[model samples]
Every structure is written in C-alpha cells, then in structure tokens.
Target: MSNVLRIALVDPSDGSREALKGKLLGMDTIWLEADCSRYEFFPDVIEQTAPDVGVITLDSNPEKAIELIQRLATSAPDTAILAASEQTDGQLILRTMRAGAREFLTLPLSSDDLDEALRRVSQMKFGSADAGGRSCEVYAIAGATGGVGSTSTAVNLGCVLASEPQNSVALLDLDLALGDADVFLDSIPDYTLADVVQNISRLDIQLLKRSLTKHSSGLYLLPRPVELQDTLSITDDSIRKVIGLLKASFTHLIIDLSKTYSSVDMAAIESATRVVLVTQLDLPCLRNVVRLMMGFEEIDDLHNKVEIVVNRAGLETGQISLKKAKETLGREIFALLPNDYRTMVEVRNNGVPLIVQAPKAAITQGIRELAEKLEKGSSPAAEAGEEPAKASESKWKKFWPGVKQ
Candidate 1:
C-alpha cells in the first residue's frame, strides 16, 4: 500500500460531484486521486474503484447511499465512507452513522475543511498500521431528552478534562444546529464542526489545530455553527477523517451528542470511547433514557460502554430513587450531580464552564470527581498522574489493556 490516499467521489448531483472532486484535486499536498464513476451506483462504484476513501454527495437517494455504506463496511472494511450535505437533520445524521457513514459535510464548502479531511484519511491509513487499527477514545455525551443539561455537562466535562496540564483534549459540539457549546464556553470560534465536514478530504493535525479555538485553560474546542441556517452532514469517511485527526492531536476527546437520534449522533457515538447519557429527575428524561438504553443494548459492543450520568441528581422531584433508578436501568449510575441554581445562573450569565467559575460548588465538585473517575478508569494515566512527564511506563505499555497489536 503506497502512501497516496486513493479517493472515490460518488454523487448524483453534478455541481457537488464536480466541485468536491475539483477541490480535492486542487490541494497540493494531498495525494488524492478520485474515481467519480461511483455516482451511478455506490455499491457498483466501490467494487470498481476500491478506493481507500469513498465520498457520497447524494441528496436525492440518501437511503441508497446508506445502503451502499452498510454493504461496503463488510465488503470493503478498509474503505472509509464520506457523505456530503444538502441539509442537516438529527435523524438523518444518526441513521447515516449507524448505517456505516464515517462523516458528514455541510454545504458551502470551506478550504480548511477539505484540507483537513484529506490529512485525516492519510493518518487513518497509517495509524491503523501503527496499532491494529487506531489509538483513540470516543466519548459520547447525550441528553436523556431536550433541556436536561447534556450540552452544558458535555462542554464542562470536556473543558475540565482538557484543562489538565499534560493531557490534550478535543471537545466536539456534535449538535449540528442549535448547539450551544460555543455559547456555554463564551467562545467566538472562527470555525465549527460543519467546516470540518465540508472539507473532509484534506484534514491534518496542523489544520485540525487551526480549526480549533484553544482556551487559556488548555482545552481545544470545535464549536458548532452560530448560524441557524448552516447545514452539517458528514459520511463515514469524513467522520473517520475528523476523529482520526482529533485522535492524533488529543489524548482525550469529549463529544457533545445531538439529542435527536440521527446519522450524525450515531456516527459520533460509534467513534466514542464511552457514551455518557445525561438525565435529570423527571419522567420525560428517565423514560427517554430507558428507551435509549434499550436501543443501545440492541447494538453490538455498545451496551457495555454506555454509562448513565444523572445530572441535577438531588431534587425534590417525583422521580425514582437513585437505587431504584439503577435497578430499573440494570446499570450503575456513573455519577450524580446536585442541582445548584445559583452557580448555574451565574455561569450561564458569564457564558463559561461551571468548573472554571465555581470550582468548589457542588456541581463543579461532582464534575471534577467524574473527571478523576474517567482518568482512573483508563490505563497508564491512572498509574501515573495526568502528566506525561510523570509516566513511569511507556505509552504503549499503558495502553496494553485495549491494545490489540
């Protein structure tokens, strides 16, 4: 296998098909050669091109594209699937991810996104060889339902984890539209995850870092789109590309999962090291979590990795007790957070992570506890502190628990 990243662009739309292919060709460093012939039928196209990366810009027959992705995952396990966006829908995004799409690209492409996507593909090819596949963790943070503090929890947890001096973390705000991760952190990012999707063919570490907005706290944030009209859709190839890019740069990655079950959310969850389901003391949230946990259990390899996080845990609400909640779900409560209105209001007004503004508060304390739990639950980092200089063992040795190679 040569270093050149072979790419196949499959799309029925003439404009998107030509535009995407042309953009990849124009990039000088990315050795991307496209076989656009896959636009006819993705399955047939994959058979003929057998590219390392496959790009699907299908707007008319999305189901067909999904079918092709599912078929290709088994037929060609090495080929990465990328999907171009015409619009953004939570269900569509999740469905695509579960169907085997790696990433999604929103319309009105950006040069940075294209550049980064290509770099991601190249890295994925090499990283797989370095290990058995790739060295990364996928952390999924999903709301039990809407307005249960999932976005806030995801953002703060990621920010706190990223704040550790020696550890690098990437916080991905996966809620395509109406995602408030930027607002929560009070950051004015130049780019969002949507940019990464549109330019899935040219992603690299340098480009990925450039796309990020680094906080003084040392956290790398990939924000969501500020504009309500902007679309974000990615394919398996693009998701893999972006995830691979993040993995190379950061030791820990925390993903803010979209509340709605769509192709995008599923893709993010599959790539996550752990899935954190954030719930509140309410029937709606608990019921939703119950349903979602059941749904996750149906998927292979996901049931064991899913963790239920009870946010705003202690309240005078008519809900199941903590023990009963765990009994009902048949899983342990990963963590419990107290409901603190004063701190939440203050942090919301300041537009900063609660951990930064209220370190000693109940919620913040719980978050810190959760962070430490995650750090310990993993390998080498647990034996040593979070600092790399303090590591007594090799990084590879630390990774022995999950390292297959």
Candidate 2:
C-alpha cells in the first residue's frame, strides 16, 4: 500500500476550505484528489475520486454536514471519514463519532496535532497497534460556604499535583459565573469553559489541550465563562461530558466547584473520585459541611469519598477546635491548613502559586502534605464504616424538611 493518503475534502466556508486545502497540499504524505465546496456535492467528489480519506468540515451547516457524514458512512464503507470543525463541543464530537467518523480534527489546526491525527488514521487503515487507554484521578474541591478558600485550595493542590514528575494536571473552574480561578493563577485565557462546551462535539485530546490556558505552575486551567450570561448555557450534562474528555487527556482533573450546590456542581461532585470539602473552624462553615455531607450520603456510597479539610486553622485563638469540628460533621478531618495571611496575600497578589512563591511556608507545606495524603488514598471515612452525622441531622432537617434519615 502507498504511504501517501489520497484525500477528498469538503468545507462550506470558502476561506477555511482553502486554508485546509493549502495545508493538505503542503503535506508530502497527502495527495489532494478532489475538493468540494458544498456538502451536497461531496459524495459525488468522493465517489469519483475514491480517495483514501473524506474530510468534511461541519461548522457552516452542522445538521447537513452530519447528514452527509451519515450518508457517506453507509454508502462508502471503505473510505475512512475525517470530521473537522472550529467548534469542540462534546455532543457534536459524540455525534460525529457515532455517525462513523474515524478521526475528528479542530480547525485552524496545529500542524503537529494534525499530523498526529493523520498518523492515527494511517494506523487504523493499515492495522497498527492503537494507543492504550489511561485512567484519570478527579478531585472536586468545594467550599462549605462562600469564602472558605475552596478555590485557593484547589489551585494550590493542582499546582502541587502538576509539579509531580510525569503528572499532567488540569484545573477546571466549575464555579461558572463567579469563578476567580483564573485571577488566582493570573491567567488571561484566550478560551474559556464556554468555548469548550460550544465546540465539544469536535473535542479530541489535541483540541482539549489547546483550549486550556497553561499556568506557570505546569497546571492547565479551564476557567468559567467570562460573561455571566454564558453560564446559562453550561448545563449539568455538559459539565459531565467536559470532565469525561478532560480525563482522557490529563492524569488529574481538579475541579473548583461553586457553593450554590446547583445541578452543575452536583454533576462535578458525582464525577469526582474524591470530593475535598474545604471549610474553616466556624459555626456557619461547619453547619454547611453537615448539610453537604447529608446530601452526599444519599448518593450511592459517595459519603465515603468525602474528605473534609479545615482551612485557616488557628486563624483566631477562640476558633472552634478540630475535635469538635470533626464531631459536628461525623467524619475525621482529613488535613488542616495553617493560617498564613502574609504569605497567602503575597501569593494571590502576585498571581503565583504557593509552591512557587513560598515553598517553605507553613501553608504551602500543609498543601503539599495534603497532596501526599490524597495520593496515598488514606480517607478516614472510607476506612471506617461511619453513618451520617446524627448530631447534625436535626439541623439538616430544619434546613431541608423533605430529607429523610
């Protein structure tokens, strides 16, 4: 078999189609057999040319583009289908994959990522060994209440994880409308979570990696939508799909969830391998923890995944004790982060992570230890068969009358 790929291309956008054609023509391993500007004419072009691959761009008229893919998939069984789009939305990708597109490419493509996708096609056509699947550890970090330092904890933890050798970590700011994770990291992303969701259909590993803004700490971040209105389009299912895709590309996905406990937040929590609930030694925070724990218990053994961490520990001399805090939640405290106002203020102000700004600081060391403990998978709740906090049950009932024991 000749190594060169004979290609038939279809793209409705004239400019993008020409740009793609130019790229294909430049490749020594690809021969452009035919090109069509319309989806209606693509099948005829493919039939006449009998190219090794049929490249279809889906942005101009997605419904029709998808129809063309479906028709070509059935009518031309031997021709491998390659779907291209500017959008990377997960639903579109799933649909294209289901419609029998062997490879999906994102437009304004990177030469390297394009080459890699083509190489996969080559492997598939000529029968070569495919890459093995990888598993991802997802940690969802939520605050017991607003200002409990969940985002701070998540950012630092993600930085620590990224610092580890051979660890590819992504921090997804799922706080949607109100997330400030980008501000914490001092990253001004060209793309946000909204872009990823809108383009999810074409989202492959390459596209996902490109959509994120990489922090100096070696962690990739997907911040919440830049506009508040954009958050309305971000649904629970979309969050789940985004997480699923992120897992395929990264070793760890750290999610910073909003305190609203909305469906979107719950979806993230549901997908997490560990839910780190960050709180302070205060009545309001502890009460929120108890309420959240009660809700978590209802989800299939999810209580076992909960790990409570007290932030701002010893910030005040009269603050509640750790022992009483644990008793209130009916679970052991996973870790305690020391209060280091001066260092944290500087770290946040400078948009630098704790590990980088003050590696020797007590809070930094505390976060590093927390990362180690998480890696060891030593959750006290998981180890002991403890029921939901009966002590806080009455308080929970007062807040949520419909909830039963």
Candidate 3:
C-alpha cells in the first residue's frame, strides 16, 4: 500500500464503468478498492472501503452526482473526489469544481489525462513536495487599436521568454477572428483553441501539451480556430478555464488578444498577472489608449496592472514625443519599441520571430529590453490621483472637424 493510490468508482452506465475500471486496473499505481454502479450506494462502498479517492461519473444524472460530491467533500474530507462527464460546458466545469471535485475527466478519457489526474491525487494524498508551489506568470497583450503591433510584441516576447532555460512558455492567440500567432511562428498547428475548449473537461498537462503547437523557439502556441464559425462557440467562461489550465502547466502564459474589447478579452485581461497595452504615437491610437485606460479604471485593480507600451516609436519626425505621450496618458511609458519597418516586414513574411530572424537588429534588441523589464517584474508607476485623458468630443473634433461638439 506504500505509494499506491486507492480509488473507489461510481458510474451509472455499466459499459462506461467497465471501461474505466479496465483503465484503472491497467495503471500499476492505482488500486481499485471498490466499484459501484449507482450513486446512492457509493457512500456505503466508501464507508466500507475507505478509499483514498472517489471517482464519480456525472453524465447519467449530473445534479445527483454533484450532490454526492458535495456530501463526500464534507463527510469524507480525507477522500479526494474526481468527477467525470461527457459535457464540456464551462459552467458545468465551474459547478463541478465548486462542488469540491479534486479533478474532472471528460468521457472516453485519454489514458494520459487520467494518469495525470491520478498523479495529482497521489501527490495530494502522499504529499509530494517536489511537485508543489509552482506558479505561472500570465501576460495579456492587447493592442490599443488595429495595426499597433500588439501580436508582434506578444510573439516576440514569448519567444524571448521561452529562450530562457528557466521558463516554459505558452502563447495563446485570443484574437479568435483573425489570430496569426501561429503564422508568426510559421507553425500550422493541428489543434487550436476550439479543440482545447471542446475537450476542456479532460484537459490535463499531457492533453494540453499534445494539443498545442510547439515552435522551434520553444514557445508553445494555441492558435485561434481556423474557421470563423468556431469562434462563436468560445465563451468567456471557457477562456477563463483555458487560462487557468495554462497557468497551472506553464511557467509563463502570453495571451495576444483581439482589438475588440469583448467579454472574452476582458476575462483574459482580468486573469492575467499583467496587461501589456501596446499602442503607438498617433492621435487615433492615443485616443483609443485613453478610452481603454478609462475603461480599465472602472474595473477594480485592473488599471494598476496595465502597462502602456509604445510601438514603432520615432517612425516619423512629426510623431508624438515620448514625454508628450506620457503626459497625455497620465502614466509612464512602459517601453519604447524602436521603429523598424523593414525588419518587421521581413520577420512577418518569413514567418519567424524577431529574435530568431535578426537577433542583432535594433527592433529585436528593443523586444529583448521589454522582455527583461517584464522578467524583472517591473510595473508602470502610475502617478497618484492621475486620470487618463478624457475623450472629450471637443478636443477630438478640433483634429477631425466633425463639429459634433
């Protein structure tokens, strides 16, 4: 019994129960103490066997199954509960977690996923100190407006972070409609975010690693769905679940969000350890930055996490100065990415990141500096009581002559 994980199983479907039992029996570390076909009798079995873990399948009667989990959580606090269901709905996963499930498995479970879940249970029961206390740093990168090079910054930063031997990085493209993080890496991933969400219930480290496309630079990427309609199925809750799983598996998670401030993007932003708001020195971009900052101010502590980055700085002689841009935003500029149109174009066309294409280029060096700043855990030092520039209709109308104000 030393180093063995004892499991009690309950599945209303006899076929599913048999299949799960067969899988469990195959694992050398698992000990199948007792098996039951009904939820009502599972408690009695648990009482008799006193199994270290309880496995419950919820497809037959989810409500009853969840009730059993809740009961076991309180009554058998020593026993870890593992829930299984065919449903991949994010709400169901959230409910299952809240009901005190130590792990959740999707139907027709991947053997690897099941093994990983059991390993987690083993650690929980036996106290594996080596596998404890790992945390992932998530950085959500958003463009102030279209064509502001937000995705470029995210890809390059992820690449640089992945280059460090200490970091295991994953770059998630949240720009569902038009994400090209995979394109930037020159990777045609067999799996995408749609696939991950479809199998969100069984998403363990093994499944997740297999689903992502690993790049030559060592950064793992979960690209957007290939089809436009697939994006419709992706919900905010699903995005949160994905982020949670990614945070658990990787040392660093980089999310490149769409310019549209949708609920999904906001969910990612809220989950992120830091929000890198990439912008430029132009009037339109600056205006959007002001609007976005104002919106961030409304959310609790979101404004503090925002770090404004200026891309393509000094492209034009008439471009806004860094000092003026900071004064306009009422916050310090987090970084100034040098304007290198030729190098960026080459990298984009070649389907490679800046660090790999031209490591010595000024723009590549700028990206490295940005990554260094982030690695050092430096955040924007927003002035006390400072307010972002108000998007006054009068101020903008003067520039465009719309004359609405």
Which prediction has the highest lDDT against the true structure? 3
* Candidate 1 per-residue C-alpha lDDT over 1-405 given as tens digits, one digit per residue, 9 for 90 to 100: 123455777777677777776676544233343455454466676676567788776585887777877888788888888776777888888888888877777665678776566566666776643222223455788888888888878778877887776567788887877787777778899988778878767664556689999876677789876666555365555665676557655677888877777876787787777788889766677667766755664566665566778888787767668876765654567788788878887887788787679888989988888778766554332243443321233222222335333
| TM-score of every model versus the real structure | 0.60, 0.66, 0.67
Residue 231 in model 1: lDDT:
51
User: How many angstroms is residue 242 displaced in model 3 relative to the true structure, after the best TM-score fit?
Assistant: 0.6
Per-residue alpha-carbon lDDT of candidate 3 for residues 1-405, written as tens digits (9 for 90 to 100): 025566889999999999998888655455567789999999998987788889999999999999999999998999999999889999999999999999999988899889788778777766894343345778999999999999999999999999997788999999999999888899989999999999997665557889999999999999999999999989999998788667756888999999898999999999988899999998888888876776776677787778889999988875887877777776688898999999999999999998889999999999999888887775755435544433442233333333454
TM-score of predicted model 2?
A: 0.66
lDDT of 2 by residue, 268-301 (tens): 9988889999999988888778777767767776
lDDT of each: 0.70, 0.84, 0.85
TM-score of 3: 0.67
Clashing pairs in model 3, backbone N/Cα/C closer than 3 A: none
Off by over 4 Å in 2: 1-134, 385-405
- Candidate 2 or 1, higher TM-score: 2
Ranking by lDDT: 3, 2, 1
Lowest summed-lDDT stretch of 10 residues in model 1? 389-398
